[model samples]
Target: MPKQPYRFSYLLLTRLLLLWVSATFPAQAQSVYTQETALARDTVPSFKRHLPWLAAGAATVYVGGLVYLNHTWYEKEKTRFHWFNDSHEWKQLDKAGHFWGAFHESRLGADLLRKAGVSEKKAIWYGGALGFVLQTPIEYFDGRSPAYGASFTDIAANTAGSLAVIGQQLAWGELRVLPKYSFHRTPYAPLRPNVLGNGLSEEFLKDYNGHTYWLSVDLAKFLSPTSRFPKWLNPALGYGVEEMVFNDAAANRTLGLHAYRQYYLSVDLNWQAIHTRSKFLKSAFYVLSIFKFPAPALEYNGRQGWKMHGLYF
Candidate 1:
């Protein structure tokens, strides 16, 4: 089966819009701080002023995005509501993209709420669920399209991503494990430009072979406060897929291509840990935090026993 092009484009647009909104608005002054300080900051009258504007902006984007998608994409192939089982598609690489997208969206929602003077408990619960709220509705749009249908697995991945943010906030009062993404151009795209993508920008979202989802662990967080370990350094595990010109195994095999999974062990940078008082730099770091930094990596795949990269993106 071929992949849905609109699905990839929709995800890419949604993420970019959300990132823009997050960067345009001011985030909480500090990324790492005590629970008490967080609560106290919410009491500031000035912070409450942003709540209405933020709410309005978010609502506008939500409705506007759906309208645009409906006209541009869904209208081309309207259908009765249906279900799609894409659990096995793209070697589950698409699922990883969903997880990564939802996680960052949820994180941004929570942080934006905190900045708007919402209480810690409310922000943690309501804001943490924002990613699920934002992404799930698109499944309805998908269900109505003949080219695609509502995917249960996609919903599950979205839910898990939201829970990840909520769980960390409730347990550790901060994010210790961060979901990040990295991409590199691949020759596979040329084989199926219409499906994989035609250019760098499109391939960034549509090319599963180029995508790598990572879980970056903040090791310094577990150490004592006085420990000299670099707080900005982290260890990360990554997952990717390769040699897939088509979603179906048989189709790819007919073309002499075999899909294989890739696992990676690498180092990442904790951009949030770098102390900075500049609001612009802080926002930049918050947006950049969603990506895994390129570093030396060890990789393993069933097709190729083991491999190493001096610097893997």
Candidate 2:
């Protein structure tokens, strides 16, 4: 079966909406901190008056987004609860996306909770599980849709993402290994606009061929604080796929298209590590940390063997 583009679109839209709601509070709260006090402020918890507003706003967006999604994406379909095994689709790139979305969402949830003066233990457990909590319902919706069925692997990926954040917070008290994402325009989207995308915005969500998932490690975090290693630089491994205009192997082969996975060796920027006193910059970096910064990359794929990009997003 061809993969449903709406699934990816729904994830992307929900992620963005949650991020916007989460980010707004921290950005506004930035006005109270000075450079000397910023680090100290983060470590201490004090219940803020705005936490109620934050909770209300997030809840509103969560419910509102679901209502909108059901109306726009699921209303026309005849649906009944069912399970789907899409573990093989899109070379598991969609699973990578699920992991990325859940990781960042969990990270945001924890950060927001911490900022709102929630206890450390509560924040770690609750906020760290936020991504899974948010994404699992969409699977329920999928289960009922004739076009898409609930995927066990998708739930597993979401769980892994949340666990990645939860485990790090419990052990290291901060994230050292980050899951990130990057994208570029691809010609393949025009080949099937309905499934891939029709425009830049839709393409970004639906076109798996243009998407790359990265795992970036902060080397400085492991080294001595006195070490001279650049705090902002990280070594990253990336995974991507190309030539997959159709999710079905037979469908792709009929058109002489073959899908192959690509691996990348690249460097990334740890935006949060960069020193900045500005509250807006701090908030911006926190949000932007989910993206892999453009840099020279070495890529290897079965078809191409090895190739170098001047810069790869």
TM-score of each: 0.93, 0.92
- lDDT (Cα, tens digit) per residue for candidate 2, span 83-128: 9999988899989988998888888888777666667788788988
Cα shift from native, residue 24, model 2 (Å)? 1.5
Candidate 1 per-residue C-alpha lDDT over 254-280 given as tens digits, one digit per residue, 9 for 90 to 100: 889999999999999999888776769
Model 1 pairs whose backbones collide:
none
- Candidate 2 local Cα displacement, residue 246, angstroms: 0.4
Distance from true location, Cα of 95 in model 1, Å:
0.8
lDDT on C-alpha atoms for all candidate structures: 0.84, 0.83
Q: Which numbered prediction scores highest in lDDT against the true structure?
A: 1
Question: 222, model 1: CA deviation in Å?
Answer: 1.8
